[model samples]
Target: MRITVFGATGGIGRLVVQQLLDDGHQVTAVVRTPAKLPLTHSHLTVVTGQLTDHQAVEQAVSGADAVISALGPSLKRSTTGTQVTDRTRTIVQAMEAHKVTRFIGLATPSLADPRDRPHWEHKVLPVAAGLMFPNALAELQGMTEAVTGSGLDYTIARISNPTNKPATGRIRSGFLGHDKVASTMSRADIAAFLVAQLTDSRYRRAMPAISN
Candidate 1:
């Protein structure tokens, strides 16, 4: 499979790229700073560009089987307020133009899923996030809305707290309130789950909150 990845320089994003290469898939990574992405492989192609650049995004997505994004807003308040949202919109536009359907993007539990039942964490987290990181929360909410409304085969993997621990391959994915999910999951494991979605159809057009 040929894959194109956004946020390739990010923590989980880089791991996603490496995992794709290790799995023998041809990879194209689009990023603003190519130097930040240190991976080099015969099957990996690095394209330097921002996601907002339509032509650059299209060059990355033109012939890919799937597009996965580990992109998220900074925890700190964003000055522009809609950085991730804007980039996600650009990517969606590019994918629509190129007729690419499969899209896997990231979000937090703050983005609600219809399957989510009543839970305290689901209730409190979004409120806390709104008060603490309003810009980031808004950015993710907007990004989620864009992807969900894009009319593509999209899966938004919502993660809980992320740690730097190694991949366990033991991940729990489901709606937040209904599933017994841990509060923290390893970044490596999250990357594995995200990359695995390239072939997994169970979560197509569904947002599954994942944790350890």
Candidate 2:
């Protein structure tokens, strides 16, 4: 499949891009600076541009079979600084213009249905974090809303902690607020799970959570 990735220089984004290439898919890595990405594949096309720019996103996404966004900072300060969700909005518009479907985004567990979370933990940790990072969470929420509202075939993977460890190919994914929640997952696993989603039929319009 031909794929386009925004924030392709981020931790999870890079892994996702590499994994997509390893899986034999043509990948277009969109970023502000192409020199930062460590890609050397003939199938990998590095496009330099900012995610916030509409024309740049459209240029990267054109002719792609699917578009995946794994853009997020490991340590976030304010929602205003988060670009993934905002970038996603532009992506949605571009994809529609380009007529591309199948959008897979790396959202957070915070966007999961409130009722699905474990009650006690929900009230304390996750819920508190949601309030604390309203903007950050909003980005994910906005992306999900935009995708769903855009009428695209979307799968929002609300992931837990994404570590940089080797890909184990094993992790747990549940609806937001699932009782058994772990705090982390290797970035490798996240990327692999994303690749698997390209063909998975069970996750349409659903938000699936992942953790180690």
Candidate that would win on lDDT: 1
Across 1-212, the per-residue lDDT of candidate 2 in tens digits comes to 99998778888888888889888999998878877797899899998877777888889889999989876633464437546667778999999999998898877665545347454434565576666765666666676777878977888777756677887766787665454657689988888888889999778877777777
Among these predicted structures, which one has the highest TM-score?
A: 1
lDDT (C-alpha) at residue 100 in model 1 = 93
Which regions of candidate 2 deviate over 4 angstroms? Answer: 73-75, 78-83, 114-121, 176-181
Q: Rate the local accuracy (lDDT) of all candidates.
A: 0.89, 0.77
**Model 1 reaches what TM-score against the true structure?**
0.97
Q: Write the per-residue lDDT of candidate 1 for residues 1-212, one digit (tens) a residue.
A: 99999999999999999999999999999988888998889999999887767899988999999999999988876445687999999999889999999999899887778988987877889999989888888889999999999889998989869999988889999987788876689999999999899889989999999988
Clashes of 2: 2
Give model 1's clash tally: 0
